[model samples]
Target: MTKRRALLSVSDKTGIVEFAKKLVSLDFEIISTGGTQKTLTDNQIETVGIESVTDFPEMLDGRVKTLHPKIHGGLLGKRSNEEHVETMKKHAILPIDLVCVNLYPFKETIQKRDVTEEEAIENIDIGGPSMLRSASKNCESVTVIIDPIDYETVISELSETGNTTLVTRKKLAAKAFRHTASYDALIADYLTNQVEEGEQESLTLTFDLKQSLRYGENSHQKASFYASSIPTAFSIASAKQLHGKELSYNNIKDADACLRMMSEFKSPTAVAVKHMNPCGIGNGKDIYTAFMNAYESDPVSIFGGIIALNREVDAKTAEKLANIFLEIIIAPSFSEEALEILTKKKNIRLLALEMREQKDISEKEYVSVLGGLLVQEMDTLVEDETTWKIVTKRQPTQTELEALVFANKCVKHVKSNAIVIANNERTLGIGAGQMNRVGSTKIALEQAKEQLDTAVLASDAFFPMADSVELIGQSGVKAIIQPGGSIKDQESIEMADKYGITMIFTDVRHFKH
Candidate 1:
């Protein structure tokens, strides 16, 4: 049997000494650098320093250790080729059969509030990625391990077969490449942010793979979850699933939508989502009342929908939720009694998302388009009596004004071009994702039917054409709230004036397509 050689370099030393001892027992020469070499040597396992093998010393503050051609040539050379063997013999370079490397903890280091720019830059690995990539590129000849968690399995495989199989090596190489890619992305994003603080042109995003889902939107497609390198206040990707089956693609999408909506409310709120749209949302004195009100909004649509609560779920709410066939329930916390009650339903997915402070107001909203993504400042503007401008002859009552504000809040969360019709505190009708503003207004009024006579309408954006105003008038909507900024705004105002309808301009558009 040929004498195999394995190089090890890792920031995480968990299980390293034991692994090195096992490899030594199997007669494999252990090659390592710096701290890794000391770690193995201190454990009484013989190890050769990488500098000695390369006939070069580590320089540039240990940054130039593993970048030598001898190290790469050993990893890249093919054992079966006579020409490669002769070249290695001519150069007097030993073959490296395996490479195990994990990158520096740049992410962990930067997460420290007291970390300086110099410290963050120092954590960016140079020689480690070069060695990993060189080893992975020649996976047909060498095994590359990027994660320490896989060390035991690799050692077990080698012990059983005397070598890692080709399939295993290929898998490990793919993992190594992904690790390097994620590491590089993090560094790039950090540098970009440091260079350009407030400009949209300088925005850089890096997302790390969190978990692979069961499937995509459909059973045929594949899907995975990626979390942003920059942490957010309350992200579904960061949430912990306490119990139940794996989340499907649809579940996560709906859950995220619901969570974003719930984040807007300060009171105890509950939102029920179906197919990435809110079926029901209500705020009440307590979580149980909120959930009950949301459920009562549309009980039929709540079936098999995802439910999210902004407050801790109590036993009363859990019992009510258990009676239905919901897909998932996300809340800040669940009482022990609530968990016991909910656990009786075997298929419901439960998640506990710790609430954090709201994100900074400056974070822009992003939406994916055909070829690129659209980024704009988030619409955090809210309407009050001072911000509302009444431009029509008719006046709104206090109750109608309150309903208008509530309906406007609902419209902001809906897909554009959207219109919401509500009376009192309950939504009477919602038209979302329509082609035109008029079309959405007509749909909302039509859904309200006779109730449109007294219901207040809230539009996400200004009506470019006066047809929407006429349509609302024909449907008997008494009052309207809209973000007025269209060039043809005067035409819409005239139409509402002619009908003697009450109109309030919020002056802030919320287009959420």
Candidate 2:
């Protein structure tokens, strides 16, 4: 058999010298370009420049080096086919048995502060992706390596078998394709942001596989996590799971819900999530007390729920959490003792995330339907109190006002057509995922029982009809907070006036689904 030919071009040169030396000892010819060739030659390893093999000089400042027909003819040629072999011979092209390439650091370039548009555009690689795709498409004959961490494994397999296995080549080819696709996505996203203002074009999104779950929402379905290359605040995709059994689909869903809720508060707060809904939420003097209050709000609901805290986990809080049979715990930080204690429970997932400012209130929203996705701007900001106009004779008391605010915050996180009734900063009843406004109001009041008479009501959106307002008055709710954007707003206001109920128009909507 003829000696195998290997092409090497990489931005990260870690362990390349030793790798190339071993390849040379094995009688594989090394072909590289630019900085990669310089590094290998300086290390006393004989190397041939890619320009020399292609018989074409690097042009456009090295961007046109590997795009030549000679490089691609070698990578794409099929060894088993006589036609392909004859074509390569007629073109004076040598077969490339292996390809090792990594793209330019577009992510690093875009992350730099005050980076110009020119700088970002320059980092987009042309030749690198073309070479990677060419090699990956011919995985039946060529082995492609993209990640540097796999260098040792590839070398070991090659040494033991005298050639890279087909299975290994296929796996590496898949990785290379994913790498190039993600790179293209980053470039598209960056350029899209530079377009004219008020551009309504959809954002091009791409994500890499993070992990596969044991199952989806149920044991019968399958699920997997895909993380974006673009970072976001309170991202579960970036979370480091310190300990646990493999995270299930439900665990990840609830953890994500808890993280989003906890990110909304500036003061120390804790939220308990179960089945992608907030079971309990509270703020206190410190993290420990806050967690205790949140747990007490609905202990039965929190039995196996996920907990997220905005503050660091201390030993005291950790001790209390350790006593519960919880599924997951997430916080910005955890004390050394706390982590040590928590890790003892092998089945609980503990995640530590770097704290960041809450995502922009105007970020895009997405919902998955049976066939496609529904996209809109996230309805995040609650109505400012200054804009609220009381349309009734009765005014809410200071305590009732505070309770209304708390209830509004809770309702914002609930599913659309939602109502939350609260008293003394505790959620007395939450009616969520309902079809109509009146149905939600009835469910909330019925759940609150006797406390419904004294509690304040918060609606996620405006009452389309006066029946919702009348329903609240019949329950003896003292104050009502709503966005007040319905066409029949006058009818609702008149109904509130007749019932002596204090109603405020916020001019902001909080629809969640």
Candidate 3:
């Protein structure tokens, strides 16, 4: 009887020798190439060099090693077909019963800080994916393995039954295809980032399953978190949870919002988020003062909200945070005393993040629609104050200009039609997600009823009519900042001048849906 054959070529050689030894004990002949062959022979296990089977030398720096017909014919031949049998016998192609292959480290190579285009292209494996796909397509006749974690399972079945079971073959084949698809996806993403411009003709997205959530937006829906192949320092996917219960779907959304909001500030800052919108935001000299100002910004809305701080959490800050019933607290790090106190709340999530990974230039944002996906660049273009056009007769006071900048940053992250009223670097009231601009203006003005004096208002977009500006002026806000592109800009300017309020046009709009 002819000995069953197994081909092995892998980048990760975790247990290749042990797996090959087990196959040899089952009367299977091992076939390998390059480093894999060297490793097996060094372990005193026998292996048939791939050149002996292909009858061709590896050329083009090992790029042309496995493209020969003899290697593929053996892996692709239909064992049950008489025509296939005749062809194999005519070509002297021995049937291959198993194939194990893993692609080169393209993902890892591109992740390096100094990786160049040439280095990235060199790591793209051409022959590996082809073998895995061909073997997976004929899973009934051949078993395919891409991960070393499955070595023992395949070895166990072969040791007992002399062959992998049909079910195991089918399962491993599916996993192998997924492995190759993700590898190809990562390579495509790297190439696009390097040279491709604008939207591509096709969009390919691939992510690893990071977690399985208990529920989606609602308890009845199922959901899971898929992390991007490339890791970022500020991403919620990369955050390390020091203590907490499992994060829910809403918790992740709120935490992500808090992080984005916190990224807008340079000083020690605190951002509070609720229902995927900013409820309060504040900047201060230290973390403790920042938390206090954020809590005071909207004390009622901060309950059960997610809070993210740019600075480290100290004992003083943690003590103030402990008084609030928050769902999550995110920072660069936590003090020993701070962690000890916060850990007492068993259900709150405490996360530590590397705050310096702000690679804004290459960042992309993705949103899933009904049947398709929408992709765009992240809204990270730094707002330029040099482009501001003061349209009103009165110039803004120095204090009001600083307040307007702070209010503009907070308003940019709010859902439209959004309005933010702030003073002294702390948000007094935030109106978000209203259908009409004036309606949102009313909500913010009412919330800041007593704090309106010397407060500045920021609008995400130009007001369609003068009514919103009229209301903002009536609320005693001293300055207003907005993107000025609407047809009715003159009417709002007239209203601001009539109210003796300063209006500035940023010439850039931030519309968050």
Candidate 4:
């Protein structure tokens, strides 16, 4: 006639008092340890101390508490097996009907601005995961809860049926294992980071679900968004949504591309992105002019594109942005008037982020393949201007030099076979992801049209043949910037010299695939 026992120990003690009180009302005894015991007792809820059941003092700085056989036996003993019941009775062990446990704040501790190694190591929970796993392993009889979000469901079922249903227990057990697995993966990743680079033999990836997208690239494909465990303040994942409808998968993609392109300039810059390609990028003394320059670069493409500005958005820029049917607008902050005007459009999304360059941290990029992943360092390196060589006999003028560097930076973000034409520090035409270099050049040349007389061209890679340079010569491009590594480089250099075009070789290739 003894009541069933429930073990409750949690680092995140959210709603524990009410849960324990509900269990007590349903004829259950609450056994707790450490801070959890203090919290429940402080709330005037009677509880059984953990040592009373284990008969062993929590030694080694409270690390050796729940790893005892008494706790595990209570959780893992089979109720339907006669031999298991006899062994449990012989050992004087009680059956634990439920377990509610959550691990320590290891992720939160590591994310602190100045957290030390010892601080993070000390927060790794040992006994908590053991108890959760033991109970989850025998989930037919023992129910386990790892998240506070599931507490109400467990309580509701227990209140109605006097115990959790088999289906409910199975789901909670599966979740408990996943919780522990993710926690362990985070620890593994942290330890791997502590080691020297290239010493890690295994990859441990951990991410938390940020949201479930309405759809993926297409409406039929399901998708979700996940944020990395390590914080990135400047990234789109860290952005805070302030207004409008939910972000789709395509919106997140375009916004990420826009932010990455925006990081290339230190001035008040604006970037317009569509389909993961920068259609327009502009820099100026102020954000409004920067946005105007970007919009004017390609008005048709910027109509429903993602816009990212490095500086805070003002009412004037917001007014112009509101006039366009933009999918999203991201910035450091928005003026009160700007928000009032922009928020009137119910379908446009606004995201605010810290526009940090993040140069100090060596960030990484991951791409998924069919059965594995590809990891590489992010392409944030700033090529040395001193290393550039002027191969063309006609040296570029100072004005052409400034515009060439701007175009060089802009071209690196474009896809392969990319060509970016710019004048006065703003893109006039961009041709990306074409099949051949000549095709991209033709497309960019056609877009540049009248502006080709003064525009400078930047290609993501060197021309394998002189055909692209011959094509550029046919247009009136003044100067060219490319990562000249092809064996036919001299042919292109001769072609540029014949056309009186200034060509510079950067040596560093920026191929984005």
Question: Each candidate: what lDDT?
Answer: 0.84, 0.84, 0.90, 0.91
Alpha-carbon lDDT of model 1: 0.84
Q: Model 2, range 306-368, lDDT digits (tens) per residue?
A: 999888999999999999999999988899999999999989989888655565334565678
Candidate 4's residue-wise lDDT over 1-513, tens digit each?
979999999988989999999999999999999999999999999999989998989899887889987899999999999999999999999999999999989999998889999999989999899998999999999999988899899999998988899999999999999889889999988877787557367787778899999999999999999988776777889899999899999998889888788788888999999899988999899999999999888989898899999999999999999999999999999999999999999989999987865553357789999999899988888889999999999999898999899999999899988999998669999999998999989888888887876799999999999999998898888799999999999999999999999999999888888
- Poorest 10 consecutive residues by lDDT, candidate 3: 354-363
TM-score of 4: 0.97
Clashes of 4: 0
Model 1 CA deviation exceeding 4 Å by range: 77-91, 197-206, 229-233, 360-388, 394-399, 446-454, 474-476
For candidate 4, the 10 contiguous residues with the lowest summed lDDT are 354-363
The TM-score values for the models, in the order shown, are: 0.87, 0.88, 0.97, 0.97
| Candidate 4: Cα lDDT at 147 | 86
How much is the lDDT of residue 9 in candidate 2?
Answer: 94
Which ten contiguous residues of candidate 1 have the minimum total lDDT?
A: 354-363
Candidate with maximal TM-score = 4
Task: List residue ranges in candidate 4 displaced over 4 A.
Answer: 357-361
lDDT of 1 by residue, 1-513 (tens): 657899999999988898888888888999998889889888888888988888998899988889887898899888888999999989987899989888889999988989999999999999889989988989998999887788888888889998888999899999988888878888987787789756645545667778898889999999998777766657787778987888888998999888777766777778888887777777778889888878876678789999999889999898999999999999988999999999888788999986545564346677889988878776666445596798778888988887787788778888899898886545677788989887888777776785666689999899998999998887778889998988998999899988778999988888886
